[model samples]
Target chain A: MSLVKTIKELKEEIKRMSYGKDISIGFVPTMGYLHEGHISLIKKAKLENDIVVVSVFVNPTQFGPNEDFESYPRDIERDYNLSISGGADIVFNPNVDEMYPDGASTFVNVKGDITNKLCGKSRPTHFEGVTTVVSKLFNIVKPTNAYFGQKDAQQVAVIQKMVRDLFFDINIVSCPIVREEDGLAMSSRNVYLNEEERNQALILSKSLFKARDMFLDGERDANVLRKFIIDNINTKELANIDYVDIVDAKTLENVETINSKAIIALAVKFGKTRLIDNIYLEV
Target chain B: MSLVKTIKELKEEIKRMSYGKDISIGFVPTMGYLHEGHISLIKKAKLENDIVVVSVFVNPTQFGPNEDFESYPRDIERDYNLSISGGADIVFNPNVDEMYPDGASTFVNVKGDITNKLCGKSRPTHFEGVTTVVSKLFNIVKPTNAYFGQKDAQQVAVIQKMVRDLFFDINIVSCPIVREEDGLAMSSRNVYLNEEERNQALILSKSLFKARDMFLDGERDANVLRKFIIDNINTKELANIDYVDIVDAKTLENVETINSKAIIALAVKFGKTRLIDNIYLEV
Candidate 1:
């Protein structure tokens, strides 16, 4: 795969690809610590498209002031190898300056209602930042179809809302989440944890799966399910509960009872690291 | 020329045009009443592109609560004929509901500095709304080049900033303003004026020209030039000045003395009809 670090170069690359034929382009956008989840997305894209272009931009606008913006992991060589193995034709890796210049000020904000429910409740500006960066990426890439992992579920919902509202002519395919054998959701931030904290982080997905099992055993009360997951996480000494709630799968409003499509999502802090996990509960 | 009122139809129309070939598409976005200014933009688009598409929608978001949104002049038949005569291949005239459907919550906003200096001061949130609508139009039309008249000078600056900030891969062309024989800048809103109001409106362009003449005669002080234009407009019994200023041509910031490039822009009301005009000065 060819590695391009500038917007001009990537655009020229796209122009060269579009020369003689109508080639279907597929894109996967990520912040550059490649994992199995991102690799799976790239593999799916490679399967579906004639030309696969992946962008690795650690978009600063998406991170909060106190978040792990500085400490987020970055290994370009590893990411490049994984992308090429997963079948990316062009790998676009732009720096902060190229993505956001000195006077850059435009932002794309998807409204407050749906965003303010899940992770957005804690990170108020997170989804807005995500939507803005994704909008910029979408415009830059102009892919026929874009691939996104379902690990960031709220992100998928927010992007769907943005695409529909803005009428972007690109299909957004939310691929299934890739998880560890112990049920922990795979994340680039997983690198931040030590052995003990990493083991304790498994409580996140463990509690989620426990909640899922309780629902399958005919538990209907959302409060009961929410309490059960919180209690399980509380048993672990290192796990500090951030939020536990059962919300509608699409609209993300807090549900009192599991009458329709719902998801049980939770976030917890282990030392300085924050981890999130969720499971869809459908009857 | 085909007149499409629905987004689906227009998109399908665009899809048909993109079949097996790479053809340049030029877009001209406008509020319904087509004046010679709009005609000039369309003509430019036709000259520069393989497909010239013009959209006539008086986007409500751009107007202030007190602005004449409902009274904005519109004639579908007149606009359609004018678009065809001006060499347009497609005329997209979507209704208010069609453009902004139910649950449309996303917005594109460009930040303050440059947008805040000129018209943005009087009409806060105006440039943000313009940028949102223009961004949407750019995505929908997928133009190789988009045309805008220099009549709305601040608008061109705002759009340029948005395109740069958002990384939209489309070229923006700012066409020269079309004018009447007596030097009144051509606008769809000009139809709202009575004969007396129309005659009085010419003072806007006349003062701008006088300021231009002063600059040619070695006048460098911005305050002196501003006062000269304001005084000229005040001489008209029916003219009511809204704003009069001399600003840097590129930044739109108020300049004390014009050393390089500058533009004298003003907005005035004559019997409830507002008119704006400007002249670019290079010394």
Candidate 2:
């Protein structure tokens, strides 16, 4: 395993590795502060590809004016160890200046109703930022397959749309979400939760799991399922609901009733930290 | 010297040709009315790389509502012969549906003053279309180097900026403009001109050449050079001037004086055919 800091160095290394042979590269892009969610992607990448490259970049463009860009968690030493353990062949950790240099004005955008719902409603420019950085990383890495966690289900859909719309010659592998033993979805932002908030955050998973059971038990109405989840979250005083939506998993469009593939996605604020979670409803 | 119509076939051919042992591809993208201008790009690409791939696509999005997209010239038979004569290895001729399939909504945009000036002023959404299509082509081809003609000076600048901003692992080669024996710059749209319009359109190049000579004789004022070119073109009663300005060669910003590298560019319409020409002033 090697750690490369510069784009030029990384490109040269990739070239050296795949010079006269067929080498399959699996890429996992993340914003530092690694958790089991990130490692799951790397482990899957390692299982499938000859080379696994993981990029840790906390892109500032994805954060809004009032978002936690300045206070976002970052621990590189711990991240490096986790990445090694997860079987990453290369850890490409680039600084902001290296990724987005001066006079960098180009952007890749996936427009239409797809980018205007769910997480995109609150953070209008979030998907644009995600697509732009991902495009750049894809060009730099030239991976055969790129891995993304389904915890960010909307992100996966947007990225899948971009890859198809742009005709990128790479496969996008979406890994299933990883969760803690207590059912709280694994997230880097979990560190922001204090002792009291930590215990209170469990209500998020509890509500989601309860709704999943009801959904399995012939609960088909979107309004009733949405109301149940919202009321359940409101039970915790520290929990402030941002949005609770039951949308088509692929299109991210609202569904009247769940007859096919749907996702119950939500974002809530536990004090200053905002966390997102989702459960897929498959028929 | 194979002509592939689908993106899949072209990509497979490229992969077969470059399976191992270091193969460099040089790409030239064109709308396929193959003139000396496009042939020059292919010739240059042939000299520089192991294989040259010329894409003949008449992109519709670059044309405005009132522009001549439907009447745009195309001749695949003639294009294939010219490409073969110019030493091209492959000719990628994808239909509009192949390049832009159903549900295609992604776009690559280079913002700021670079895309707003020059030809962008008359055709507002032109560069967005150019960048989007070119980015898609780049991803599909994965060429070692891509070539563009300097006749569209602003396009060369915009594409260079996009490449720098997006971190695409390809080199951009800008070739010199190819012209007619009488001095008219070569373009696919030249086919739109009738005999009378053709005779009058020579004024576009004639005025530019005269201005270049005057600038060579120590005329430094940009306004003076601009007026000289505009006056010379206006002498032809059939020519209707669109714009005549002197701008910095790289930045495309309006210049007051020619202290460094500058370009005096103009566009004029004879009948319904809009013709463009430019002359560079290098210190």
Candidate 3:
């Protein structure tokens, strides 16, 4: 497996690959601290295309002023090894200067209620950064298909909306969320939690499961389902609920009664770490 | 010359050509009523790229309710012939439905002060539409370079900003505006004017030329230059002045005095037809 570090080199490599007969490129984009969740996306890309390229760059634009951009974990050597083991054809690791040069002024906003709700409420500029960087990577990789994990549900939705809206010719394949044995969703931020905070973070997924149970048992009231999850999180001594709401799955708007598809999403603060989890429920 | 009226056929044909080639595609996006101005853009694209694709879409989202979207003239056959004549490799003429299918709920917005001044004021949604459709076209064509005419100065600026902010890897090439012998800037909306209004429309460009003359004669006061242009437009018997102002060339903010690079722009109403023109000056 080859490791590429510069955008020019990557573009040149991708350009050379495009000349090879019948070569299909697949891409998986992520920030450096790779895990099973990222591996799942890479694996899916590997299965689907003739060549798979994984990009690991900690994008600065996606994090808000108060967000954990500085503390975001990085293990480039380990990530490179894992990407090669997962059958990635190439790993693109661009430095900050390459991805974002001086006087970079453009931004891509996916506009609408979905971007204004959920995680958007706190991290206002998050989706814009994701869309902008992904667009850049798409051009550099020139992939036939790109893989994204469903762990960041809103990010996936926002990207899907952007691709469709912008008429992107590349296919966006979404992989299911990868989780630990105890049902905690795997995230790069998971590394930030201390032992006690990590244990308290489990409640996020548990609350999502509890909401799923309520839906499975034919409870359709969105308010009641949200309250159940919120109350459960409140019971945890270390957990502080940021937001708990049941919204339309597609539009991401708060729904009074769940009639069709709804997503129960929540973000909680465990000590100083912020964790988010959600469950999609269809009635 | 072959014609492609559907996106699927265009995509299929592009895919076939792109299968084993490192071809650099150049895109020229337009609202088709092909004229010398649009042909100039297409010609420039042909000179720069290995594969040149031209899309003729009269995007509806960019037009305001009081604007002339419904009455916008279109002649697809003429446009197709002209595109082929202009050396475009592929002419994508998608219908409204093909570009925007039912239940489409996505939009790309290029934000900041660049979108808050000049043409952005009268046509609030204009830049948004341009950014969205151009973004869509960029994705669809996956071009190595995209061409725009400087006739739409603010639009070229907005798109340049969008490309930078979004991290699109394609080069943005700005071609000179194609003008008539009398120096009236070419535009599709020129078709809406009657002979009398057409004669009066020349004043729009004349005013900008007047400002240029002032700059050449060593007049550097932006407010004075702007007032001179507005006064010139006001003197035209059939023309109603909309806005005449001098602004910073890059940011499009009003300038008190012209120091380095500045743009003098105006919009004038000749009966029902609205005409716009601009001139960039460096002191």
Q: Each candidate's DockQ score against the native complex?
A: 0.80, 0.86, 0.50
Weakest lDDT window of 10 consecutive positions for candidate 1 chain A: A112-121
What digit string (tens of lDDT, one per residue) describes model 3 on residues B65-171?
88888899999889988998899988898887877776565666667678867788888988888887788778777788888888787898888877775667779
Best by lDDT: 2
Residues A1-283, model 1: lDDT tens digits: 5899998999889879778667889999999899999999999999999999999988888788899888899988889889999999999999989888887888998886788876888888888788888898899988999999877878887898889888898999989879989888889999888999999888888888888898999999999999988899998899988888888887778899899989887889999988887888987
What TM-score is obtained for chain B in each of the predicted models? Answer: 0.96, 0.98, 0.96
Which wins on lDDT, candidate 2 or candidate 3?
A: 2
- Estimate, for each residue in A49-106, the C-alpha lDDT of model 2 and write its tens digit: 9889999999988999998888999987788889999999888999999988987889
**Candidates, ranked, lDDT:** 2, 1, 3
Per-residue lDDT, model 2, residue A150, is 89
In order of appearance, the predictions have TM-scores of: 0.96, 0.96, 0.86
Candidate 1 residue pairs that clash: none
What is the descending DockQ order?
A: 2, 1, 3
Cα lDDT of model 3 by residue, A1-283, tens digit: 7788987778767766657565789999999799999888888888889888999999998999988788889888999999988879788998888887765656777777889888898888899889888887886777889999876778888887777777876888878778899989988888778998888788888878878987899888888888888888888899988888788766677899889877787888888888888888877
Per candidate, native contacts kept equal 0.79, 0.88, 0.66
- Residue pairs that clash (backbone atoms under 3 angstroms), model 3: A106-B165, A106-B166, A107-B165
TM-score of chain B of 2: 0.98
* Candidate 2 Cα errors over 4 Å, as ranges: A18-20, B19-21
